[model samples]
Target: MRVGIIGFAGSGKTTIFNALAGIGGDVAPGKAGRINLREVQVPDARIDKLSLMYQPKKTIYASIQLADLPGQAPGSGGGFDANSIAKMREMDLLVIVARAFDNPYINAPIDPASEIGGMLAELLLADYTVVEKKVMRLRKEAAKGTERDLFEQLFATLEAEQWLSTLELSEQSLELLTGFRLLTLKPVLVVLNTPEDKADHDSASELIEPLSSFEAPIFALSAKLEAEIAELDPEEQLAFLAEIGIQGTARDRFIRAAYKSLDLISFFTVGEDEVRAWTVQRGANAQTSAGKIHTDLSKRFIRAEHMTCADLIELGSEAKVKEAGKFSLKGKEYITQDGDILHIRAS
Candidate 1:
C-alpha cells in the first residue's frame, strides 16, 4: 500500500515520515516537494513467534511502501504543484499530518484543526477541477456527435458533481465512477502532531469544535519527539518512550491503521528456502491473491490448502498440525482470512 504524508508548512510532515520510515530528511520549513519512498515491515506478533518456533534460514515479514510527500500549504498557494497532485493521485491512502505544536518564527503556524479543515477544502477543490475539466472534454465530444457509453455516463456524473458526496449511488453508479479515480473520494487519515509534553492529549476533545464535520479517525503523536526517539538504540528507545509514558510506537499504529483503512490483510507462504508474508485486500479470494505472489502462480492455479499460523504455533510442527486434521482444502472462491498460511497445489 502506498501512503502519502501531507500537511501545511512546518507541520512536521518529514519528521513523521522519518520516524515511520527511518529517514532523516532535513528539518527545514517551506521546503519544496521532495518525495521519499521506503518499505516498512508490517509488524505481526504471530510472525515473530512463528520465526522463533521454526528457526528458519530466513525470516521474512510483510511490508508496505510509504511516500513522504512535501508539506502542502494551500493557503499560501505553495502546496499544490501539478507534479505533487499527480504524486498524491498515485497513493492508495492519504496521511494528513496536522501541526499542533507551537514554533516561534515559523513561516506558517495555524490552529491544527483549522488548518486541516482548510486542507480538506483544498483537496475537494482539486478534485472538482479535475472533474470540471473532464466534463468539459466530454461536452466537446458530445457536441461533435461522439456516442461512447463511458463518456455519456461521465457526463451524467459531472451533472451531479455538486452532490457527489451525498449521492448514495447503487452498485452500478459506483462501478461506473470507479474508473474516474476522483481524489475527493479517497479515504483520509488525520494525524495530529502534538507537543512532546502532550503527545497523549485527547485530540478528539481538542478538535471537537473545529472538526465537527470531519468523519475521519484522528491519531495524535509527537512528530519531532518521535523522530528523535527513533534515532536511539532499541533499548534506549523503549526506555525513552516509557519515561514519556508512551505505550506503543506511533509508526506501528500508523502502518497498521493505514493497512485497515486501505482494506489490506496479510497471508504467508513458508518454506525452508524463504518464509515470506504477502498483502492483499481483506475480501480477496485464493485465486486473486495468488496473482499478488506471481502471475505464474495464478495461471497454474488449481486448489489451495490452508492452515492458520496460530494453529501451527500451537501444534508445534507442520507434521503435528496436519496430523491434528486442522488443514483444509479450499477452492478459488474461498476468501482468504488474515494470518492464513497457504500452500497452493497446481499442475
Candidate 2:
C-alpha cells in the first residue's frame, strides 16, 4: 500500500517521514515539487516470532510505500498543483500532518483544527474541480449513461462541500470512479504534530474538538521527538520511548492506524526459505488473497490449508496443530482472517 504524507508548509511532515522511514535529514521544504518516496517494512511482532521459530533465510514484513510530497502553504487559495495532485492520486491513503507544535517562527498559536480544516478544504476543492469538469464534459457529450450519472452524483456531493467517501456509492458507481481518482474519496488520517515539550499535554483534546465530527481518525505525536528517537540505537530507543511513556515508536503507531483506516490485514506464508507477511484488504476471500501472492495460485486454487499465528505459537509446531485437528481447510470463497498462515493448494 502507498500513503502520501501531506500538510501545509512548516507542519513537520518531512520530519514525520524521516522518523517513519528511519532516515535523517534537514527536513527542509522541497523545491521543484519533488516527492521523497520510501518503502518501509511494516513492523509485525508476529513476523518476529515466526522468524525465531522457523529461522527463515528471508523474513519479510509487509511494507507501505510512503510519499512525502512538497508542502503547500496554508490558505494558499490556489488548489493543489497538477504534479502534486497527480502524485496524491496514486496513493492508497493520505496522512494529513496538522501543525499543533508551538513554533517561535510561526506567529499563529497552535491550532490543529484550523490546519486540518484547511487541508480538508483543499482536498474537497480539488475533487470538486475534477468532478465539475467531468460533469461538464459529459453534459457536452449528451451522455446520460451510468458514467454520467455517477459523475453527477459526485458533483452534487462535492457541491454540498461533503466528501465522496461519506456517500454510499454503489459497486457500479465505485467502478465508474476508478478512472477519476477523486481526492475526497480516499481515506484520510489526520496527524497532529505536537510540540516535543507538550507531547503528553491535554491541550490536544481542545485543539481537536472542532474536528470531532470528522469521520477520519486523528492521532497526536511529536514528530521532532520521533525523529530524535530514530537516531538512537534499538535498546536506547526502547528506553527513550519508555521514558516518555510511549509503548512503541511513531512508525508502529502510524502503521497500525493506517492498517485500521484502510481495512487491511496480513496473512503469512512460512517456510525455512522464507517467512513473509502478505497484506490484503480485510474481508478478502481466499482466492482473492491468493492473487496477492501470485496470479497462478488464484487461477489454480483448490483449497487453502490455514491456521492462525496464535494457534501455531500455542501448538508449538504445525504437526502438533494438525494432530490436534486445529488446522482448517478453507474453500476459495472463505474469508481469510488476520494473521492466518495460508498454504495454497494449487495445480
Candidate 3:
C-alpha cells in the first residue's frame, strides 16, 4: 500500500511524515523540497502476541509506503507541476495535512476548513483535467467507428467525470469509482495540526462537519509533539502520552487509519523460523494473497490450514489449536480475514 502526504504550505505535513517514517526530511519553514519516501511497519497488536508465542528468528510486519510531496501552492513555484501530480496519482491513499495550529511563523495562516476544501478542489480539478484530455482524444477515435466495448468504456469514463463534477455522490457511487484511481476518489485522511496542549479539543467539531459527507476520517495531532515523543524510549513515550491523555501514538493511529482507508486487510504466515504479516485488499482470496509471498507458493495449488491468531493465543500453541479443532482446511478460494494465520500445505 502507498499513501501520499499533501497540504498547503506549513501544514506540518513533512513533520507528520518524519514522525511516521523516521525520515529527517527538510521541515524548514516555507522551504519546499523533493518528495521523500518511507516504508512504515504496519502496527498490529496480534503481531506482538505472535512474537511472544513463537519467538521467531525473524519477525516481519506488512509495510505501507508513504510519499511526502511538497504542498500545493497555487500561483507560486509552478502551481501543481504536472510531474508531481502524476506521481501522486499512483498513491493508494492520501493523507492531507491541514493547518489548524496557532503558530506565527507558519508558511500559511491557519484556516483548517479552507485548507481542506482547497485541497479537495485541487484534486478534483486535477482529475477532471486528466479525464477530459483523455476523453477528448478517445472521442476523435470513436468517430472512426471503434469497437463497441472500447467505445462503451470511454463513454463510461466520460460519464464518470461528468457525474463527479456536478453531483455530490453518495458513499456507494464513490465506492464504484475505486478502481479508476481518480484523484478525487481516493480515500483521504485529514490530519489536523493542532496545538500540543489542545490535542483533543472539541472546538474543531464544527470544522470537521463538512468532511462527514465525504466519508473521510479526520484525525488531530500535534505533529511537532509527536515527532518529539517518537524520539523518546518506548516506556517514556507511553508515560508521556498518558500524562497528555493521548491513548496512543499518533504515528500508530495514523498508520492504522491509512491501512484501513485503503480497504486492505492483513493475514499472517507463522513459524519459529519466521513469522510474517502480508497485506491484501479486502475480499482477496487465498490463492491471490499467496502470490504476494512467492509465485511458487501460489502456483503449487494445495489446501491451507487456517486459524485465527486469537485462537492460537488462547490455545497456547499451534498444537493445541489443532487439538481443539480450531484449525480448519481452507481451499484456494477461501477469503482471508484480517487476523488469519495460515499454514499452507502445497504439493
Q: What is the TM-score of each candidate against the true structure?
A: 0.88, 0.95, 0.87
The reply for model 3, stretches above 4 Å from the true place, is 23-26, 74-78, 144-181, 201-207, 210-214
Model 2 poorest 10 in a row by lDDT: 24-33
What is the RMSD of candidate 2? 1.7
Write the residue-wise lDDT of candidate 2 on 19-111 in tens digits. Answer: 999985556544536678999889999999999999999999999999998788665656578888888889999999989877665666666
lDDT of 1 by residue, 60-155 (tens): 888878888866653586447778778888888888888778866475655777777767766666676776676677677665432244445444
Per the 3 Å backbone cut-off, how many clashing residue pairs does candidate 3 have? 0
Instruction: State the TM-score for model 3.
Output: 0.87
Tens digit of lDDT per residue, candidate 3, span 128-179? Answer: 6766665677677765443333334534654564324344555654555555
Best by lDDT: 2
Ranked by TM-score from best down, the candidates are 2, 1, 3
Report clash pairs, candidate 1.
none
lDDT of 1: 0.76
Query: Clash pairs of candidate 3?
Result: none
Residue 321, candidate 3: Cα error in Å is: 0.7
